[model samples]
Target: MIGAPMETKGLNANRESKPNRSRKEIIEKKKAMDALLKAASAEKDHLSAFPAFRRYQTNGLSAFLESGRGDKLASSVKHYIQNLLKANMEGLYGSEWPVEERVKRREMVAPEARYIFVREASNASASEMSTMSEQESTSASCVEKRGPMVGFVHFRFVIEEELPVLYVYELQLEPHVQGKGLGKFLMQLIELIARKNQMGAVVLTVHRSNSVAMNFYLSKMRYGLRRVMKFFAKHSVMRLKLSWRYVSVSTRNHLRRFIWFNKVVNSTLFTKGQNPAIEVLEWIIQFQQNALIIVI
Candidate 1:
């Protein structure tokens, strides 16, 4: 009878120990799964590195992607962007933003940034081309021989709303190159890169006072305005949705505006007593309205 009681106690202890062992095994499996996910993410980032060379035949321009954690290169890019912004957005930002301070801030964040430089390709010397096997070295020398830098696009890959996107921080070109369709070419290249990397969208912010830029993005490129926030109080966020085809409805609207302007210009009322300056002001107001249609 005493042996029976002892056997029952032994069975109860074995049952309790089984649950503990099962719990430990479950914990181990969960940890392993977490580690595997982390490793896979890192591998994907490594594999998705941007290509060093891209050529746009329409503009006779070639762009090279410079990506790394190098501070010197980042500084150079920051300086370039700063010059561009000072010329383009100084009025929009007003006197509150000093160029030097803005450049400093950009430099601090640039180590994590990637730059696409517009360069001309030079026929490399035979000896240098034959001796260089490393792509990095080849690119560095190519930049040196390719003459002065004409323009650059600074962008980064980011996750927004749980989707991967390419964010364009700045796209700047020299005054001589501005009207030659290079800006559109650069944006096209950015979209292509985003698509190649499986990004969902391309996003950028434009200053409200920069009407030319706003028109280029909305009417020319068909980027839809996502939202207008008071954070900057003077900027609008624009996004190009990559999942759908972009219709040229905006183009048709612009054509209609042009036709209306021509009709008004030819009208007797416009020529009889109305001042020419008044007509110009009317046209400007209409243009502004068209640009703001997508804002809010």
Candidate 2:
């Protein structure tokens, strides 16, 4: 009888300890997430960390990246964004665009919003040609002559599904700049920023009607579908998990040859044939190799 009481007390103690341990783990996770978000938000300029990505020059296209805040966006910049979004996305949204545009305008002005503006460097003024390091080119407040804006990416760091993520709200590029490897370059840089900040993933949404955008993200960028939003039936969430280590390999020659890519055209997510998932793995292997950094 005496031993039975002791056994009961021991069992009760063990049961109590399980919840306590779980509670401790939950608290630790929350603390870690809070710390990650705080650090990410504190950094004023993500592109500044990646000086190499500041300039993308290839295929006769030259551009530079500068950071901006949504709330501080000049009227001209806001107008450009609205027009660009409409130009690129209206066909996909059809009759829903005006309402959606209003929502996007409101979202774009949120204080937490962040932007990486891509500007034409080919016609950059003499002052813009001079090094901006001394003046901190990454500063959102720094006003310098940036050649006509060609593209912009608006993203934010937020917790999604209990994981810290860099959520890309907008990636609008002028039609003239499309297909010049600039889009791929921008996404690569964004993924690097996410990894640098210990984010679990880079998340975004794509419309079903936008086949080109869908193919670009899933096939070229290695993003997988997270899920379809319940309310936004026309949109699907896409995510590129950043926890995976980047594999380094040279794929330029392989891409030029298109030997394997030719075989998988019928296997991708969109109507236009694309390289298959194995091809995606091949891209994953070579993706990091292209990430060259030149800190100037």
Count clashes in each candidate, considering only residues at least 3 apart in sequence or on different chains. Answer: 0, 0
Q: Candidate 1's residue-wise lDDT over 174-228, tens digit each?
A: 7766766778877776776665555545666665566777677877776655333
Backbone clash total, candidate 2:
0
Q: Candidate 2, after superposition: displacement of residue 273 in Å? A: 37
Write candidate 2's Cα lDDT for 24-56 as tens digits. 976887788789888997788887778888777
Superposition-based RMSD of candidate 2 using all C-alpha atoms, in angstroms: 12.0
Candidate 1 residue-wise lDDT at 10 = 94
Off by over 4 Å in 1: 1-53, 57-78, 99-104, 120-142, 231-296
- At residue 135, candidate 2 shows an lDDT of 41
Where's the lowest-lDDT run of ten residues in candidate 2? Answer: 256-265
Q: How many backbone clashes does candidate 1 have?
A: 0
